[model samples]
Target: MARLSGLFLCGALLSFACQDLGIAVEVKVPAEPLSTPVGKNAELPCSYSTSVGDSFALEWSFVPPGKPLSASHPILYFTNGRVYPTGSQAKRASLLQNPPTRGVATLKLIDAHPSDTGTYLCQVNNPPDFYTNGLGLINLTVLVPPSSPLCSKSGQTSVGGSAALKCSSSQGAPRPVYNWVRLGSSPTPSPGSMVQDEVSGQLILTNLSLTYSGTYRCVATNQMGSASCELTLSVTDPSKGRVAGALIGVLLGVLLLSVAAFCLIRFQKDRRKRPKETYGGSDIREDAIAPGISEHTSMRPDSSKGLLEKPSSASSVTTTKSKLPMVV
Candidate 1:
């Protein structure tokens, strides 16, 4: 009788201690992450020990990726035989089983979006029997494919110089990686002459040569799908350019010399055939003494010969003086 009384006293003290400090409760949850495509339903599995009572309660909360639990906001909760949905997802959030009193507190989400991608916390408290972490964590992800990437190039593509190829996408749920490939048959690049960055989507080439001239393609890829773009590089030789320019200059110089020589020869022929000025015929001078009339006198008739031989003035005077004296 004395031992029985002592045992009852010890049991009462033990129950009082349990009431002050809560006991451990077991919550069952999956070890793997959850996933679903956009615009589809998703299930985050959670459950606990069958500790149904008048004050039984359960809560589901969420936070974005990389955020702490302290930042989580309530999505839905159940207590006092009533279910209340809350937060931004309240309209589409619900429980898998009516009144999760049967131990199934799995979260049900309808038409999930990329914004819903994050971590979820499920907690349960059965009064007088819960204390040590009656909670579980779940990670959810939304799958998405890559978008068309923009292709571009930088630096001159001349021989003995360097060039870089770039590619990028404007929108994609999961960030994508890049890859490059030559369109036609291409020789293997020397070890140190080429460099590529898959994350940044860039390919750099040094010591460019004529063999590097070709069309190249870039592909952006993720878990869902891939998109691609294309670009071309044409390497030119500097020596060939110099040779062509010199040949053109020489041809122009020859053409100019030929034109100058033709002009000089034409001027000489025109000078040799030129005529001289004349001052004869109608332009004769009218001056000086009269010409002799001897030729005209000889051509006259014979009767006129006596007139041409008539006397000198001195002989006529001498004969006239004697005749005048005799008459007086």
Candidate 2:
């Protein structure tokens, strides 16, 4: 039993000596996630506690959202007291800690895009300091401002009916949230006769009335910025609408009838002014010859004998034989 006790004591001393000779390397980063608006710079904080040696290396790598760590690629590297940036992030990324030999390994990224949102790994390698973990993780989020929203109506919205007004914005990071307001009204629109959908950005107005006619505004907001759009709603009395339509139709019919009558009258006048055509005939004149004496005077015997006698010239006389007239 004494020999076993002596062996356990020696083993404990050896374990303690090994512990004293071991070098610890630990990496630390912020516990909270980091965020920045698009087109801005982001600084990833990283620090380490290690028994570093002359042969030390620091590496910064990125793993895109939803990707495995094995798929991560190097963003920058530090070795031999020199910094080397790599991949697409070479021009935009740099070491915040110059000579990064004093346990500082922060990285600065400029002009961050939405695609830059992901996980970053900071790893430190000191040859003789390998007992403790030497890696840190950082999560970054990139924000994009909302674009102008589109507003539209989906129903007739007449009196005693229903309608739906919708608003949407397609461009924004973190998905934009939407709100609606009735123009010229309070900031929080009264929800007395309408149903609002916060998720879909739709408003349903039930049993609509003329009082609902006005301008409506839609606002979309995200972490970065906001945008708005406005639309007008007009309501007309159904009875007045029908009366106006009837009057318009009657006036149009009257106009059509007047045009048809004018066209007929013009056609008849043109026909009357045109020359008439004659077929297969020559023209005869009534004044070509003079009329003879009256029949009663011609029947008298004395008138007949005078007509038979020829007139004598001043130098010569001519005689003609006469025939007696028979009474029948």
Candidate 3:
């Protein structure tokens, strides 16, 4: 029992000394890059040399390609015999070995996405053993096929004008290269008449003619796969278009004149059919105002003349019996 006690005291002293002196940590990772298709799993291998320590900790972080290390985003952490996940990758990232005390600190990623293609850092810390080589870097690439391209046209499609046809793919890994081809036999283009940019997928046609009118197909290809799109370009003569527009205008003018003539003719016919509007006074100025007054007014006044002779009896009687028409 006394010897065991002495041995325990020596061991305690040695452990304290080792902690103060510190041991260099060695971490290993693959030098070559690792690749996985999108939506697949990836294993980022990481290993370290160190005794299991109570103060041991493991961290996995990611930095997008072309970015500085300061942009590291934490994926997960392993400490105190528990796993604590962090960031968007928390649900997909995990340690290959639980309780990584056995030295393997490999990182496993499930359902890898295209956005996960970047640089990953695996770091191990065992207290005083963090003096050197405690971290490693890994490059991950997620393969993706080219998506369907969008085909479009720009500028004028009329003859003797400039025009452009464009094609592009919105999604692809390793960037897709574009190629343009006319579907059918095309006339040989004159020097400097046509220009095509494969990188930007733009086909420029200057001094366009009827020959340029055809179906064009663009193919985008990459390491994964290829996708294609098509567009139809129609060239026309501006003079013909102007003539058609003039003809349409003349037709519209004729239609408007016909409508106006029809309206005028209808107005005259309706006026002829309508009875004239008149008032009661119109009849008063006629030969006789009322039926009963006609006989009495027809009787001439007495032929005998006097210095101040009044109207004859027949005229007076006719005026008295006549009924005036009521005005509305």
Candidate 4:
């Protein structure tokens, strides 16, 4: 009975030892995130430890940022001892390890874009060696340099007023940070006078004074690079501007009034120079009398000659009448 018990204990111990030695495959990747500039190549390191078999397979996949791991798409695959790049990344991606069955399944991606910023999954599979999880995850960031910022200003910047200046860059992957600087010698001109919003890239000036007027620059910076733009601020006296505007308005009003008066005066002078046409009864009577007086003067000369010749006829008639009365 003692010999039988000793054999049973040995068998039990040997079985437990064999079970412990049957651990499964495990995968490892970099713990820290990887970063690279846009249009550059990025390497995703991956490794695994297991009893590799003749039918080993490795797969590389990607999931965009803010997406679930299950949504990842295959980037490359290794089967039959050959690497096959798949999906949109096929032309730009390749295996770093030639065989990939040696537990190294690193991937090299060329010409990465800003849209490639996401998590990458490396999976290894070998039948009968899958006791453990055979997966690894790596986070990648693709950096884009900032383009030149567009600077703008709003609100009244005159003395004793407020003004807001804004700056922005549209072409940056991770949103660019902004910094505003006034190009002058006065450092910290007034505490709390200038306020800045880092995220929105807005600078506000309160109780604006002439000292705040100068060349201002806005700089946008990101992990990749920086860009900047400049603008000049000119402070004017509000009273002077209003006075000048009032003067211009007054001059324009005077000019319009002068033009109207000149037109009216020219119309009056033209009316005075034109001759008036008369069509009254007195004008017609005067025209008729002028011809009648001319006719009477011409007939008076003939009447006087007739009167002088009528005296001879009157004497002959009186002598004949006296001879008739004596014969009776």
Candidate 5:
């Protein structure tokens, strides 16, 4: 019994010495920040060095925030380049041999669940002396909805004019909610504000005025996040009144074009209806007299009476004028 007691005392002293020398038997993995997503693999990296390889026992364990570390079962263990068996880890965890000869024992997790997030520890122990140990922490964050709404105008508005604006999002989770925001800088409110189809998230300003202009923003949000956009607004001066003036100018232009076209068409139709005049004489004449003082009428050589009437100088009188009735 005395010998056993002495041996126990020696073992305790050796443990104290190992701890004093920083022989990490029970140790921390990493105290820094690390994050992982759900349903993905996460690696818990660890390494240790020891003087006694034959008696060294390397182990890995995980405990959530409030739980005790060693009280729970170890996830994985390695000893002398060989894997030690822990039956439950078969489905959820495995020991990864990353730089195995250098005493690096990394824990690989498959299909990590939300509950798997926690603080992990790596421990090393020898029969008479502790070698190395470490602690590491991992944080898992699940994404949420988008937030911070923004509304804006696409084009500038003139006084008493119409304008369109587009509202959109910058960042958020999938399927975010969108809305339009109308804000005024002045203390007094101008009450003629109107929005278009609020369900579709479009804003239309009709009959815009200087007082109606201010700032506009489109806001988008979700359960996990929120965002907003803003822009300064101003309307054209009343003196300019470009909206109504532009409309009037356009109407005037259209009216002038229509009048010009009508005149051109009437001129063309009149010219077509009137018989073409050639040297002030008709092509064919029956009872017409030539422009001369003779009472008998002169006929063209191509007329029906051309063969009847002999080719005479009197018929081809240059100054002959026909007594034809005036054309209506």
Candidate 6:
């Protein structure tokens, strides 16, 4: 009986070790970019290919951009047939072992942020000297608000014209959503074409015209927040051919107005600087002749000071007119 009991104990310990330290050290995850944003949850899944009912250990860790991996930075760890994680990670990370009958371990991240973007590795351990390599790598990227959308037009040989526009964004933690709206008209009843490119988040529009012209808007939304770009379109009319004439007329009017305003201002400034003297007044006439001379006589050294010095008797003489005075 004692031997049987000892055998059972040993088996139990073995099972526990397999469930804890002896997990497949390597896991398989997709090798692609993970789209995430701040204040949201993200998932990094890993699975192991092993016999059913086999026990193993799984660990998930995130290494900084340039840092190497180690047990100290483990986000989640499965050991001693139980799960353990850092306090910070424990609150946000979860594990799965249901298919533990097979070897499947996955970690879910909650309240993600841009700083969370990094390289993540999933490891499995099966003990005593058995370890395996991770199946793939998961690369992550963060996205920023999208840039303003651009609208363009195309001319058809038979048709008048068509309008096209594309919206694009970049540098975000998670993928962003795009929405377009036309101004001054009812929303489009038919679904418009929009595609996310493999290389960028820009959306493209093809075959647009005056009808398509209006206010164009591109809105980008993520877990963190949202942003938008708006533009007003001036539709093109193929039938309008006198645009140059209209532009010329406007330019001419503006030029004439500017000239009139300038002349008026100059006249006011000159008027302010000149004195307010009336024309043809005695003062004005005297001032005008002051520069030439005043009607005063120069005195000789012996001239008398009073009127008694005047000549005693004046001989009066009258001259006959050379010609008869003309009568008006």
Judging by TM-score against the true structure, name the best candidate: 1
Using TM-score as the measure, name the better of candidate 3 and candidate 5.
Answer: 3
- What is the lDDT, from 0 to 100, of the residue 30 in candidate 4? 97
lDDT by candidate, in order shown: 0.83, 0.83, 0.87, 0.84, 0.63, 0.58
Clashing pairs in 1: none
Best by lDDT: 3
Q: Write the per-residue lDDT of candidate 3 for residues 1-328, one digit (tens) a residue.
A: 9999999999999877765665657789999999888898999999988766789999999999899988999999999999999999999989899988888999999998989999999998888675578889999998888999999999988999989999999988877889888888888557598788988989888999999899999999988999999999999998998999999999999999999999999999999999998868545664553554545344444557534344456445534443788789
Off by over 4 Å in 5: 1-28, 84-89, 98-101, 131-328
Candidate 1: what lDDT?
Answer: 0.83
Candidate with more favorable, higher TM-score: 2 or 3: 3
Candidate 5, residue 304: how far the Cα is off, in Å: 99
Which stretches of model 3 miss by more than 4 angstroms? 1-22, 188-192, 240-328
Backbone steric clashes in candidate 6, count? 25
Residue-level lDDT of model 5, residues 47-97, one tens digit each, is 655554566667777666577755556676767766665645557877677
lDDT of 1 by residue, 283-307 (tens): 6464322244322233223485554
Better of 1 and 4 by lDDT: 4
| Per-residue lDDT value at 192 in model 5 | 51
lDDT of 4 by residue, 157-217 (tens): 7888888999999888688999998987854448698998878999998888878889899
Q: Give lDDT: candidate 4, residue 121.
A: 96
- Model 5: lDDT equals 0.63
How many clashes show up in model 1?
0
Better of 4 and 6 by lDDT: 4
RMSD of each: 12.3, 10.6, 14.6, 11.1, 16.8, 15.8
- Which portions of model 2 show Cα errors greater than 4 Å? 1-19, 66-70, 127-132, 155-162, 170-175, 185-192, 197-200, 222-224, 234-243, 250-328
Off by over 4 Å in 6: 1-26, 31-40, 49-57, 64-72, 98-102, 134-136, 140-226, 229-328
lDDT of 2 by residue, 144-211 (tens): 89889999998876887778999998877777888988888524324777888866889888777788
